[model samples]
Structure formats: structure tokens, C-alpha cells
Target: MATSARSQTQVYELRVYEIGFFRSADVLHTYFENALIPALNRQGAKNVGVFEEMGESLPKKVYLLIPHKDIVTFQDSERKLFDDETYLKDADPYLTADQATIPFNRISTSLVHSTKEFPELTVPNSAGIYELRIYESHNEGALKNKLRMFEDEFSIFADAGLNMVFYGKNIYGDHMPCLTYMLANTDLNDNKEGWSKFVNHPRLEEIDVHGGIQR
Candidate 1:
């Protein structure tokens, strides 16, 4: 595993695409695999994650995780992508498709900053299913409190053998007051076991007892 300085925070843009039909899913997959992802790589993004949500969540969804070392790089990357002729030409299939044959029904975006405790994103191995979770808070105070819990107790997930890909506090998104994190396992059974271990961990119970949650 790799480690970086605590002050080295990364910004992430989370893009969720709503696939209305199988055809739409196919179209979007092609765009990301052939065009968008390659474009991002060329612009200096090393680990852009593309994932399909697993299970029955209706209409299907695709997630894109784009990370940048700082705010300026994040903005610059977008500008560069738009300016790239190859990207534009490759993205034309999705960009120029008629409304009747659009690639996706809608797209949602969230901009989040990495927490100090986990300043760098962890790249997952190629053989697992990722579980993405968003913990929505009621207000700013609650959000900070929840993030504090993450700072202190998140290692419990590691102890449980759940590989954490990343954890971030939302700076901009539909769900403004939330923290999103992703954990992964090699298979469904391993996912279940890891989570079961986490919920039953004594450190979590200790945190709860020590006023980790206030209501």
C-alpha cells in the first residue's frame, strides 16, 4: 500500500449516469471505455474508476470517479478534456446522438474533498465488487461530527479486511451534506463477511459509547 502526507488532499468528481435502457447502457459504456476514459488518461489522470452498480437498483447506473491533487488541477483537467480534439471526436457518439436515442436519461455529479485522515485514494485490485455508500447528514455540524467518526474509526473497516478505495466529504452535489466512501471485496461472500465483522467490531461499539453519535 502507498501512503502520502496528511495535508495532501485530493478532489474527486463523482459522476453518476442513469441508464434508461440496455441500449443506453451499451452506448455509455462504449463512450467511457473508448472516449471519456482515454481522454482523462491523456490529461494526466492515472486512476479514473468506472464502475457499474451491482444488484437491483432499477434503471441501472454507472459511476465515474475522477480524482485530482488539488482544485486547480481538477478545473484544468476539465478544460483540457474539452479542448482535446480527439476527445471531442471520440465523444461525438454520445454528444451528438438524437434525444430519442440518447445514451443516458440524466447525469448527476458530486464534487468532494478527501479527508485529512485519508488524503490519498487507494487503488483497488482488479478482481472485486465495490460497495459505494453515502452517509447523509442533517447539517454542517452533523457532517463534521460524522467525518470525525470516520477519522477515528475508519480503520475498523481495514481490520475487517474491507479494502477502502476512498472516503470523501461532499463539497458540491445534489446531496450536499454527505460523505461518500467505497469499500470492496473479491466476491459477494467476502463482502458479506467483511461487513459483518465491521458491525460487530468492539472499536465501533467503543466509539458509540464515547459519544460518537449525538441525536
Candidate 2:
């Protein structure tokens, strides 16, 4: 919704993970809050975000985005950034000398191929609503974490009028025109009133939004 105000032509994604007896979210939290965002700004990135997996289907899921003008330039600069000495030094305290916190297990890289001709949607007044989306270059990929994300972890936003909606993807998109991401609409104006109501809410404790069944 935030990007609707401007024109976004290209996107580059970097997915991080700490799973399968390896990787650690603690490290990523530190890296992102400390080094990653700054590095991205230095490299000229737009619409950046930091996400956390609130569902149990997956463990330690965090994603980041960067808008670019051209795919080739994004890829080339990304390669250099990974090996940049400055980044390495800044990323040192949180990560091991060598990316030992998480190997290449869940790491992902993609150059988005937008839908053929995308249409602009009615960009809602999603003010104060935080939005995050994660995608891979495939037909039946994974995005299971969004379930707990909207249903519980951030449910207060909905009650407070934050208006939150989130969904997972199971289909492959065609190009720039295709709606590769799902619409997660939230009432952006939910104030602190909604936040206080979250304490010990029954649904907040239950992982399943619809009783034991997955919604």
C-alpha cells in the first residue's frame, strides 16, 4: 500500500533463515537492526522491510526487500555487497568470521519478473499499518508463516482498527502485470486501545486462527 504512491519497476529480495540445526534468528535480528539496513541505504534501496515468522510451520524466517531500476545492476551490486569488506566488518559481531550462524540452507535470491502489465489497485489508507510479503520464484513455494502473523502475533492491530489481512501464495506469477503478492489489508488507524486488548486474548494464545483448523 505504501508503494502505491510511487512507481516501482523492479524488486530484488534477500531471504534469511536459521533452521535445520543451523542458523539463528538472534544473529539476523542483530545484523538487520545494525548492519543490513544501513548497507542497503548506502547501496540505494527502496521500500525496505524486516519480517519475522510468527507461525510454527517454519522456524526463523526473516525477509528483506530492495527496489531496483534494472535487474542486472541489482545482481551485480548484490554480488559485490556480499563480499564487501565494510559489510563483512559491520556484520562481524553478530555473525561468525565466516557466515557460520546460518549456512546457505534457507538463504534465497531472486530477480523479480513483474506481471506483463500491472494495474494499480485502490491504495487504501493503510497509514500506520506495517506490511510484509515474502515470495520465491516458483509455483508451489512456502509462505506458511503468515497464518500466525496476522491471526495472532499481530492480532491487536486488527482489534485496534489496524485492519490486517494476510495470505500465503501457491501459484507462480506471469510477469510485471501479475499480482504475485496477496492483498493484506489492515485498518491502519488502530490506536493503543487495540493494543491493550491483546493481553491474554484466547485467540492470541492459540496458534490456529479457526480453532484447531488452519484458516
Candidate 3:
């Protein structure tokens, strides 16, 4: 176990949604590099990462992890993003016309320490344990129950001795209809054994026992 895992820094999590039909993604990315990177640099942002779409059929989205001192500073800078002047200035004609890049709708949320960590498998070209999970609950008030069920599932995984590298969850900024998780894994027969135990638990049936929306 690489127990020396760094403390969870002040990470700002932003879900970015962009229209998928760009003529060429590379050009739009260059726009992002020229536009966003400098805007964020003006703020006190320490580090930033942007994860683009993985599978072919999905809409274009990016997950940003940036450092901030507190939510207040984050909010103040964010207001500028609403103004056309903030992202588009006369110096850049292509982006201002909104013709050169994809239009975006975004959502922002913080990643608390309680959230799960997913692995990156930094090794060279190796297939590692990674799973995309989607969660749904019928009852609007069933959040606690849902979390408990997740806890039960993780306990089973631990008993089986699987090492979970990374686990993170947040809804897509613009994509409704999905709540997702990124999982990192190594030696994951642990997952199979644990999940079987979790699904078989009798209490799971009682969770959100009343969340169906009638037509």
C-alpha cells in the first residue's frame, strides 16, 4: 500500500459540457488553451486538469480539478465567466463569433474528502482496474440510504483485499440523466466477491422503496 498518499488539497471540481459537433476538436482545444488557461491564471488557481470525452458515442465534457483557497474566491472569479467579455475579447475574433468553438453549459461542485478515489494506473500501457458506475435512487430523500448501501459495498470489497486506487463521483455539468463514478483498481477479484455480497444483502431492498415516478 502506498500509504504516503498526499492529503486531499483544496480541489475545485467543475463539470464542463460542450456541444459535441465540433468540426475539429484540436482547433477548439487551442481556443481553450489560449482562452481558459490565461483566465484561470489571472485568478489564484494553482493546478488544473481537464479530462475530455473517453468513448466515441458520448457528448463532449471535461472534468476540471483545480486548487483554490476557499469557495468565496471561487465564486467571485466565476461570475466573470458569465459575461461575454470574460471569455471572449476583441483580440480573439474567432471565439467571439462563437463559430470557432463549441458552446458550453457547465456545473460546479466541490469534491469532499468522503468521496472515493479512482486509480490512474500510471504504469506504461497496462490494462488496470477501472469501472464506470452509475447510481439511481427512486426516493428523493434516500441519499443517506444510498450512501449506506455504498458503504456496505465497499466493506465487502475491503474484506476481499482489493486495493481501490481512485474513486470520484459528481454529476455531469450539463448532462442530466447520469450520475457517474470513476474507479481505479488492482487485483479486483475483490470487486466481484464484494459486489456479490452487497447485492445479496437483505437490507438493500428497503432502500428508496418508494422512488418510482408514475406516468
Best by TM-score: 1
TM-score of each: 0.91, 0.50, 0.49
True-structure lDDT of candidate 1: 0.83
Supply the TM-score for candidate 3: 0.49
Rank list by lDDT: 1, 2, 3
Candidate number of the best lDDT: 1
lDDT of each: 0.83, 0.47, 0.46
Q: Which tens-of-lDDT digit does each residue in 58-154 have in candidate 2? A: 5555655454544666667657668777887898786564556543356654444332122122234554344544433322211234332443444
Clash-forming residue pairs, model 1: none
Cα lDDT tens digits, model 3, 78-152, are 665445465666227444546435444434454422232321211212324544454555553444445445544
Task: Count clashing residue pairs per candidate.
Answer: 0, 14, 8
**Model 1, span 1-215: residue lDDT tens:** 22446668889889998988654477777888999899988977778988998788788888999988777988798789889999999999888888877757888999889977788788876547888889999998989888888766667888898888888899988877999988878999999999899889988877876755752
Q: lDDT for model 3, on a 0 to 1 scale?
A: 0.46
Clashes of 1: 0
Local lDDT at 154 for model 1: 69
